[model samples]
Target: MHGVRIETDRLILRPTAADDFDAWAECMADPEVNRFLGGPQPRAVAWRNFMTMAGCWSLQGFGMFSVIERSTGRWVGRLGPWHPEGWPGDEIGWGLMRDTWGKGYASEGAAATMDWAFDTLGWTQVIHSINPENHASIGVARKLGSTLLGPGKLPAPFEDDVVDLWGQTREQWFARRRR
Candidate 1:
């Protein structure tokens, strides 16, 4: 994978590395953390999912960044620009460990990712496919200045699942930044 790194005040966002698998697997195993992300998956399934993210980087040159805490150098979560085949649109998604829930890492990391998507990738717009029941994620989306764009569907196995599309255009994003 090509090197890509983003730094926030307390976080270091970079491409997924081999060393991040254990923590990533642990995060996927937690039911509460995975509740909106299709429930807790076994280690084997987690491995496949992890590889998928890594593959996205190799093939597309962009994928969720392995979010790490700068102070402790811990893998906190993954969040960044992602647009898999059959996805709704250019999306900036996030999933963090349950232990790190209330600290605002999702919003912090997502804010930076949004900037990267629009500025670096030159995306015209960015969307977040969020489960309606996932209030926490909805809150993060709002914090990032994205507005709800009604219901949307995912590809394949998730096609039957319901999600709301929330996002802002590049102009809106830059406008928000000026405020």
Candidate 2:
């Protein structure tokens, strides 16, 4: 599981580093950014969350990557696949700083990761779980051609919300990509 870097038209998706603390923390601290995911977290908590995400790559063979802009090289957010505790299968997740919202970076980066999950990793299925009220993420799921797999939940490390699960199987992915 060597480090993987994915490039898009306007963004770079790469492994996160210690230097990303400030930017990542800022995003996690933004109320708008964290609203659907248990709200803004304290700095210390956010750092721990980032570290957990970083550690997942080593432990799980696949995990989210920090989303950076190509021109400014600024951290915009994170997008990739993860194996969340108790999830039935691989989960695809994405988050962007409040300031970077509405730019389609989430969808773009997520689509890239979906490609890798299916084409590179040979995964048969990938899930995207979000709170039902999170319209932004719902839109991203649609953009990536994922289908609603109905409701599901994983034990909360923070709160008690039942996350809505969306999914894309390898057959669906290949079908969508062909269009």
| Model 1 C-alpha lDDT per residue in residues 1-56, reported as the tens digit of each score | 46778899999999999999999999999999988889999999999999999998
Clashes of each: 0, 0
Which residue ranges in model 1 land beyond 4 Å of their true spot?
A: none
**Which lDDT value does model 2 have at 13?**
89
Specify the poorest-scoring 10-residue window by lDDT in model 1: 1-10
Each model's TM-score, in the order given?
0.98, 0.94
Candidate 2 regions with alpha-carbon error over 4 angstroms: none
